[model samples]
Target: MRMPEAVTPAEWNKAHEELMAKEKELTRAQDRLAAERRRQPGVRIDAEHGFTGEGGRFSLVDLFEGRRQLIVYHFMFAPGSKRPCSGCSMFVDNLGDPAHLNARDTTLAVVSRAPYPEIAAVREQRGWTVPWYSSFGDGFNEEMGVTVDDNDSFGLSVFIRDDTSVYRTYFTRGRGVEKLGTNWSLLDLTPLGRQETWEDSPEGVPQESPYAWWRLRDEYGD
Candidate 1:
């Protein structure tokens, strides 16, 4: 297997220093982008949809769990399908404790078109404790554009609320969701860069379409 070139310790340090400069530049750019995102206009939500989950029924605003900001991970599990998207499973597996995000006034949740019973079974089997709610019979997923043409698609949505008004602040999907995972974020720093089919990697490096190899966390073979 071809590996990156070996260099003397001094040379390596110098290279690292140069890369650190670029890394810092990227960090500043990311900060600026985040600031810009915070200022982006939000779309006010007027319709109400019911959701069923842990404590029973809830509305979109209730999903915020009393927090000012709500981040919902749109899981691709359809109402009657036993096939849960392996990519969505992996993404949820990578999430750390939500308490840290809660400390900053944000609540993270998962919303899917699957019935609550199905959601409960998957959560129990996979040991996921995040607050996931069912959008079944509510048209919430369809309204959010994740259930377009009656097909399930995965994404993330951000919302902010006032006393009685809720507005969607942001949304992301595909590669935009990749940065949320430590595994993907670390891989992004490597030369091969996740080795995904869509990435512009060097010739001969291993590559596959995203989710081609994803599996439920516990289903991975040793």
Candidate 2:
């Protein structure tokens, strides 16, 4: 990375204040976007969907755990695979705690096509405490648009429960999934900023091939 020229505190503060104004504007724009997202109309899901978990068979409605809202992370763990997608694993590893979400009447869980036994084994191996379930044979992943051509894909879907009815509020995939990773958010504040080739960093800033640094939290050194 190219080193920034040294400057006096007064000069640095002037530049910092200028950036702060743009940052505040961006924050307001994001808030407006979130408000619009909540205002968007949602579609009701009527078809019965089942999942297998440690607690036994569960229906889609049961996933809310009596909460008003549910967020499902579509984990890319194909049936019989020894390891899940590294990107998915990295995204999930940053989900620090669910209690904060639960406090807001939102429940988050990971869903995959892998069998419960395989899901459980990986959960144990990764030391993750978040709720996870298997959508094998139920077509939940496909119905949710998280599986295409029999290949598992990463996605985040939001649902709302009202009385006996459930509606899908929002869904996103691909790079949109980056919002769930705290690592990227942290890196964006640094000089190099994630070191991805696609980033709009200054010329001569160091960057690595995308996904080269990705590894499961437990297998970081391996």
Candidate 3:
């Protein structure tokens, strides 16, 4: 949504005044957090933890697919686990095209403790082409602390590798939810943005915007 142009000096001043301080604070905090993220201690993967994809088996390094950085979203999708977390489903629902992400020199993939077939079925149903893999065979999901028994929750993590060595760069969950983008950054500027009856949107919430019209990849528009 295009923001209304500030014609008057007062309007422009008011806009900058509203969040200038807060924006500066946010930027500083983000910068510090990113620096700390880059300094995270490495967790080596020595055991045989592999994921199965369409082509064949893939080690954790293989997931990077020769990229400099790898980001894995631990998606909850076990067979007997309670229903898929609506929050995660909603998140993946809004992910921009994988190709867009790929073009950025980063590889984003979903890892689940569920079997390959189960994850594959859900991917097909959701019509998402983003690369997903099953971490069912190995203790990868369990070791990552995302999987508990038959269920798993979501976690965002980054890893890097040079030659044959793998290093965990960063990981975040829960309070880190803000890092996941749902277009709220854009919607927050609108008068009727993200009008989910849930949030206390001061501008009366966005009511059923274009994002709401988005559907699964293979799903047809109504």
Candidate 4:
């Protein structure tokens, strides 16, 4: 394997400074992108998607926990599967404290299509605190475009509230969701990101089944 060549201090400093300039430029561009995303009009969430958690059955609005914004990770815990999705599990592990998001009037929750008791046991065993819910057989996953037929895929959906009415602000799937630490940042990447089957992506852009392409990171080559 090739390694970076050792260089004199002055050469290294100059190279680092050059890279920093481009990084800063990228940061500014991201700021502009976020400004535009905030302006994008939202679509009303009319589907009666039901979710159940340890507390009991709750409407989609309840997932917001009274926050104005709600970020949901559509975890790929397919029904009757004995193991949770490795990729989705790692995504939850990457999340920081929910309190910080809570302070900003946002709540991040993990939703899956598995039974409540089933997912709860996994959550407890894994020692995860982030709110999790079961959308089992309610067609919520199908509506969100995360589950196509027998395949189960992972994605992120963001919602915001206006007085008791809720709207879907954004959603993303595939690597479109990579490297995003904050839910809002991830959602802002596309107006209707990741053109995948089962996705409500309007006409325009190529798409395929949501659960067809992705695999555990290490299994990609297989």
How accurate locally, in lDDT, is each candidate?
0.77, 0.76, 0.65, 0.77
Query: Which 10-residue window of candidate 4 scores lowest in summed lDDT?
Result: 187-196
In angstroms, the error of model 3 at 69 is 1.3
Residues 127-163, candidate 1: write the lDDT tens digits. Answer: 9999999988988888788888898889988787886
RMSD of 3: 13.0
Model 4 stretches astray by more than 4 angstroms: 182-222
Tens-digit per-residue lDDT, 1-222, candidate 3: 998875798888888888898999997775444434434467876776889876778988889777656778787777555455677777677777544333323577888877787777778888887789988768887888887775667877767666778776566677575457534422222222334444343442224544453445345221
TM-score of each: 0.80, 0.80, 0.70, 0.81
Q: TM-score ranking from best to worst?
A: 4, 1, 2, 3
lDDT of 2 at 77: 94
**Residue 41 CA displacement from its true place in model 1, Å:** 0.6
Q: Show pairs that collide, candidate 1.
A: none
Looking at model 3, residue 168 earns an lDDT score of 69
User: Which window of ten consecutive residues has the lowest lDDT sum in model 2?
Assistant: 184-193
TM-score: which is higher, 2 or 4?
4
**Model 2 lDDT per residue over 1-222, tens place:** 999989999999999999999999997775445545655567898889999997899998899898777888899999999788899999888886565455445677899999999999999999988899998998788888888889778888888777769888788889878876444432332233445665555566556777766655544431
Model 2 alpha-carbon miss at residue 15, Å: 1.1
